[model samples]
Target: MTQQPTNESRLERGKRALAEIDGEAGHNVVAALADIAPDFATYLFEFPFGDIYCRPGLDLRSREISTIAALTAMGNASPQLKVHIEAGLNVGLTREEITEIIMQMAVYAGFPAALNGLFAAKEVFARRG
Candidate 1:
């Protein structure tokens, strides 16, 4: 019998990514969207986690930092921000380090956005405790 290609499928990659990034968090997010938009959740898994996040250049901790920063800058993605905050901690970012990242954003993203991010971080920290 001929051997199959060693390359993995998107779903397999996505499952691996999910385990690394935020297995339960991503699962809950996708599960919540299953009824309303199943395809949307699949894309969330396939694209962000499988394709983008798994790329080796940035390491998981750095990725979460950038993700937290971007979501914090958006000033409207608190829910997602909260998830990334938890993700940051999972990847070994200390509580103070995460706080500093958000605080430093105040210079460019403005006080309101920084404050919102801080609140999101606070909530995440509380939950983890």
Candidate 2:
């Protein structure tokens, strides 16, 4: 985990990162968790956004690319994949780049996963358009 300013709490840093990266979609995910698992929402922000994502090693675009690929490979996280697909675009990934990333997954993640990812990308792209 990268060091955070002593003044900024993990939740604060996470919220900032989430807003910068995921925008409304990220906030919606956190808000949706409020009634059932508010703590999970906190964890989501603090851990993934605050700790891991806030690291300096990779830029936001690269991080989004990795996230999209991993989610696509899982083949069971279409909803999350959709969110990251949008995030990928938000961070400057062109549709062509996104398609290529998913297509590359077919070799390691199988045709079904790649197809599912492509479809999810299609849905996100359509929504954006």
Best by lDDT: 2
Q: In each prediction, how many residue pairs overlap at the backbone (N, C-alpha, C within less than 3 A)?
A: 0, 0
lDDT of 2 by residue, 21-75 (tens): 8889899999999999999999998999988899888999999989999998998
For each candidate, the alpha-carbon lDDT, in order, equals 0.83, 0.91
Model 2 TM-score, all chains together: 0.94
Off by over 4 Å in 1: 1-6
Of candidate 2, the 10-residue stretch with the lowest lDDT total is: 1-10
User: Candidate 1, clashing residue pairs?
Assistant: none
* Per-prediction TM-score to the true structure, in the order listed: 0.92, 0.94
Give the Cα-based TM-score of candidate 1 against the true structure: 0.92
Q: Candidate 1 at 108: error in angstroms?
A: 0.7
Best by TM-score: 2
